[model samples]
Target: MIERRLKALANGPELRAHLLDPHTEAHLEAYAGNIEYGLGTVKMPVGVAGPLRVRGLFAGGDYPLPLATTEAALVASYHRGALAINDAGGCTSVLIDEAVSRAPGFAFPSVRDSGEFVAWVLGQLETMKAVTGQTTRHGELKGMKVTIEGNHVYLILQFHTGDASGQNMVTLAAEAICQFILENSPVTPDYHFVEANLSGDKKASAQSFTSVRGRKVTTEVVLSRQIVEQRLQTTPERMTDYWRFSAMGGVLSGTMGVHGHYANGLAALYIATGQDAACVAESAVGTTRLELTPDGGLYATLTLPNLMLGTVGGGTGLPSQQACLNMMGLAGTGKVRALAEVAGGLILAGELSIIAALSAGHFARAHRKLGRERGQEDTDTSTGQGDQP
Candidate 1:
């Protein structure tokens, strides 16, 4: 029916043939509620890294890291780091906190009116909760914060979205809450909007570093001196030296968080496991620290304050994505937190490998070897020699 309608439009037949092939048309019904205009699917190459062992509060096991990306050496880098962590009995990961926010803006004529509105809204928390409950069974209105700027008020409603990324869930709940507010409040604002762009949704912001967005997780691993020297091809002292210098560079350059390539591993994993890939903007914002242990080993840690993802909703139910989740034994109910832990572990591995490569002066060499075509010449003159330490 949808295809027939498209076929009636100009150049529709050509577009449909390219996008909606016979195979896609056969399973078109399965894509309902997931896509609009429903063309087809884009296939991305997926690579598996690990049997990565993770010891966490919610996740405990060796799981394969399925990464979908076209960039070569990404999977290999993460794979090497995962093996190093496993040699040291894996990383320790913890899901520290979880919450999604929806910040609605209200514009009043005067500061007095805004203050009055905020006070009244605070008093109506119970009523707001009731309205939110009607919107989603899996979402709960955890709390609200009122930020007043001049005559404007931003109501940041925080929610605990069970087993899902909860962007849509929180938005629906917030919309319902706003409707109830508009109807019941004695003080009406001059105007209002459903979202004020203050929640840091799909954007990187300093706010997410201080507060939770989706899921806050911390993962840490201690690699012995021998292991670092053997697996990473660098000594613990050299890695720490490079880390300290790199951290200083980040601060001088005013980067949001000091880390090496959190997006590389995370974006790949998110794509493979049916997560909201765009959330990587905020989800990838965090800190990675490497220091020398008292015993002369290396202590590495990664803390992601906005690790927004789910194991049951959005793309997770898709056939390919579900298969990837199943490969890791993390799909469906009671596994979201565990899935988050695995993400933390995966990210930590990438950080370890990338930092090691840079410190050992093998970054460009590895990239040229794995990322370049066989006959591609290294003609760039930015760095004098192809091999430099």
Candidate 2:
């Protein structure tokens, strides 16, 4: 039936042969709730970086990072960073906060109506908790923030979702809360939507830096002057100088967060670990700071305010994603917080290596040597000289 519909759309036999072969079609039933009109899977190249060492509240010891990407030089750069960090006795990572939110918008007939609705909603916190409890076994209504914009009121409902990314969990809970408000509230909304776009779902926003969307994590490492020079092929002072310049560039460019390439490492890890890869939009927003320590070492930190991920739900149950999670010993229950810490560490490693490469004038050279296709000359003049390290 699926093939017939594709054929009607003028898809050629050869295309179907590659996309819907017997091996691929056999797994269609398993993807029931995850997809509709399932075509086939695209095989992405996966690589492992680390034995990156980390010490955190939930995560401890060294763990291999499973990254799925086709981008060249990415895994190698992160691997180099991980090695440097390990030599420095690893990084300290911490999961600072965790929460998932859904902002439901209510349109009122007048500003007075919206004002009354906000007051009523504030008084119904306990009632809203009860409504959310009926929706999910693992989700809990933590708190909510009411934003009034003229006659429209946005209720940002927050939830504590255990061991899951909680996007769907919070959405369901928010819907129940909205339903309760519609039934019991004194002021009737002209109309209401479950999501008001104020929640910063799967997008980069200023709110990501100020509030926790899913998980907020901070990871830091201190590298001695000798270690920075030997392992990163750059001096601490040079790296710090380049970091200051980069920070200024970020500010000038109006970047939400100041970091080199958080998305590169995050997107790969998310894909490999069965996370909502789209969440990288906000998950990658963070600050990376590099400074010279009093003892002549380099003090570096990466603080990510939005790290939406899970260990037991969504894509985590899928075959390949589960394998990746298991490789890090982060599969199943009691591992989501640890996973967030590891994610922070992973981003820190990438940031360190990239900054070192740029500071040492090896950025373009490394790319030309490892990032380009075989037999391809370095023709991209945009990045300046591709000097050898």
Residue 104, model 1, lDDT = 95
Estimate the TM-score of every prediction: 0.92, 0.93
User: Which stretches in model 1 have alpha-carbon errors above 4 Å?
Assistant: 1-23, 374-389
How do the residues 329-352 of candidate 2 rate in per-residue lDDT, one tens digit apiece?
999989999999999999998999
Candidate 2 — which residues are off by over 4 angstroms? 5-13, 20-23, 373-389
Per-residue lDDT of candidate 1, residues 1-389 (tens digit): 66676777898877777777776678776677688866676777898888799999999999999999999777878888898899899999999999999999999999999888988998988888888999998989999988999999999999999999999999999889888888988789888998999999999899977799999999999999988887888899998898899899989998889999999988999999989899999998999898899999999998999989999889898878899999999999789999999999999989888888888888887788667755653322221112111
CA lDDT of 100 in candidate 1?
95
lDDT for model 2 comes to 0.88
